[model samples]
Target: MADDLSPEFCAVLRDAFERAGYDADGVLRLLGDSAHAALGRGEPEPARRAARDSGALGSLIRLFLLGDTLPEREVRAILPWPESVSTGVVRVDGDDVRAGLDVRPYGDDQGSWWVFADLDSDLLGGQVPADHVLGVGHASLSLARATIRRPVGSVLDLGTGCGVQALHASRHAQRITATDLSPRALSLARATFSINGLDVETRQGTWFEPMAGRRFDQVVCNPPFVVGPSRVDYTYRDSGLAGDDASALVVAALPEYLARGGVGQLLASWLHLPGRDWDERVTAWLPGGVDAWFVQRDVADPDLYVGTWLRDAGIDPRSPEGSARASAWLDWFAENKVAGVGFGFVTIRRTDSEPRIVCEDLRHAFDDPLGPEAAGWLDRIDWLRAHSSPDALLRAHLRVADSVVLEEVSASGDEGWEAVVRRLHRTDGPGWQHEIDELVRALLAGCSGALPLGDLLELLAAAHGVATDALVVAALPLVDELVRHGMLVPA
Candidate 1:
């Protein structure tokens, strides 16, 4: 077990960090534009140079972020050096000192919390160990952004490395369980939870084994979903499963662990086979009676995907070992008939007896804090699925989303200008956009809370010199699509 700092020491550390302004914004201000940008690209030299003349705040950054050695007296003035060393957080080397782990501030608009994990590539100046516990990485941030943050009774954070998700869940969930397969990860997570003054049931197990026969209101995971041919495991990256079975297994097992109306949000990667439909292949893994929304944010071909992950592993693709590994990955994909790999966010809810699936490819930038939008989208999906009949939809009142805007495109023809396309774009999740006809545009623009949708369609038909029934028939599907995708809302 990782040694826990006493409550008194935790308070002292928090006070010192707060006083030194050791936060995201604070670090950015210290490093300035060039160094901050360089640090973001996994190169710490620029930041190190910038921090050479820094004070207490710079000492903390150097020790944690860059793994630089500092004088004993300087370390003592900033923190409880004795306890930190006793706890295996740092080590003394001659007249200088270095941190054994990296702890940094992470948060959103609400507040901030510290996350502890292994030193990254920049600190080590080389490749990471296979079992290294990752800090708040891109996938971790993506999962945090994609989570639904409503009040809930219980939450499960599976594969909770360093307990970042569990810390986020603690904001709303009355009870939280964070499980991990590695004891080292769990130890760091425990210390992290303790330091944050948050209580979570930390269990050591893979996936759902520790939570057998238990159900939760919400479950979040950013699992080892990297598609690789590695027969062995990295614990954090490789699941030791062939292809994307790890992600598929997680999706297939959600129904049994999610309570009625409960949710499972995950960031995963799935293979796109050469001959099969990607949506169909993914949806087929969902258990019955669940409602799902899938947003495919990116797709990478074999060479690009392998190269990207190789770099993530800090392996040089031009090296002999890298060449062998890349060749093996490509060969594996070929044998499996994989065309490409798609990475995205998935939100699943146990809503009804019948399955409902909505899949879309949204490869665009999105708004930050996607949780609220994701929750609203799920509610809208339920509402739209319930009002499937034309008569049901006609009686409901609807309005365009507040964040939506209309865009028009035109082209010059031989003699005159011609309208190429008109689209409705929501300035939220994936910044979803949809094309619409003139009638649909007019109806959406004019909808008010008091008017029935049927009346609006009738008025639109009269204005456009079209039959009312025909207009409604042509527009209903489009309206449903808009509502389901969060472009329109129930007034």
Candidate 2:
């Protein structure tokens, strides 16, 4: 494919996209009509990966690869992006309508992509790990940015697809080695490294194979977490396993590579056993000596779970083979004690003691504020575990490693407003709203940098006219926060 846009497609693509109700002008402005022109002709596969991860720009690139008459709707449909319009142009319905900004999207040889990390083109392709089944996307950046607070030394990205996560760590780690089982991916990763001039050690091997005797400071992976049948496809969603046990196997075998104080964070899915708690089932995956933060976001019951993955793999359940495959998935779950299936994020750290493993199922959307709050989450958990209740409080202003910005406003002169924040410990009750009980207590106890956490709780509870028992319960969670922020060091 030519690097320059040809005259033949430049005009036709613009006309067709405009007719299809896309913000043809604005889309072209960012990607450049020339870029669109190149896309209309479609670039070589080698260049497509970069395009796919470019977010909005990828959409325009998508329009080009799909053909001149391709509708803007179709391009967005592939990834289910949200409908958006700018430049006084009419908007058309796309698949999904997510919100954000400064999200530079570009179309390279790989696939549709959105840029979350400030990536240099030289660092792509060859820097990619052999384990990647798909090109890098925004998800890797989202995960990477969300983990700034966690300690990472030698990062081990299991199934390091396109080395997206590994590449992100180049700025954070002393060194990075991205591993993948696919040679093609490794080749591309090498090119990626050379292209971006970013240094990364790329290896060809599955999971921890290439890094046998070595360990990393940080490991970030977005493995094949989908629970699906063993399909021929092994790059993106499909894993080479009977069912989705590949994710479990990866999870079960990952702990050995973690070094002291190192952390491994991955996105995974697991079968939900009927007779067992999902937590217990996941607990089985832990190999001891690691602290884990496991959040199960959604649970798809038997039939639904099986069908979703089947459909996700582009298989139409209406077909006979597809129906049979769905049945097999159900059977697999039932026999394996799986009640359903779940999807979400998992973060683990190699601690000195028997790791404090935490499991939570939060069915919620992960958006902006989510990335910068890693520090708050790390602190929140610490605060919860150390004390029965917490008396410490945080100013709404947040700063997570350098990625978060907390804003606070007060009404005119003597008044102020703050965002009371908390990631629910268990959705036990009222975790989202500020539990002013401790806030009031802490205020009464006086946050003078000297009063013990306990004294604050006792004083505040007395003023709020609340029952002492109830006050005690609330204080415990807050105290846990204090220990987490290092506001109260461990005794």
Highest lDDT among the candidates is held by which one? 1
Residue pairs with backbone atoms closer than 3 Å in model 1 (clashes): none
lDDT per residue, candidate 1, 1-491, as tens digits?
Answer: 15465556666677888889887778888999999899878798999988887988898888898888889888888887688887667778887888878888777677778877887766666778877888989888888888999999999999999888998898999999999998888988887787688888989987889999999999999888988674754688888888888889899997789998999999888899867878988898887888888888899998899998888777889999889989998999999888999999899999765667888887877666677878988888779777888999999999888989988998999978877899888876667788887777788878867799999988888999999999888888888888877888899
lDDT of each: 0.85, 0.51
Find the 10 residues in a row with the least total lDDT in model 2.
395-404
Off by over 4 Å in 1: 1-19, 32-38, 43-46, 412-416, 462-467
Please identify model 2 stretches exceeding 4 Å from their true place: 1-132, 136-145, 149-153, 228-235, 242-244, 334-337, 369-371, 379-450, 460-474, 481-491
**What's the true lDDT of residue 218 in model 2?**
66
Best by TM-score: 1
Query: What's the C-alpha lDDT at position 199 in model 2?
Result: 65
Error of 1 at 487 (Å): 1.9
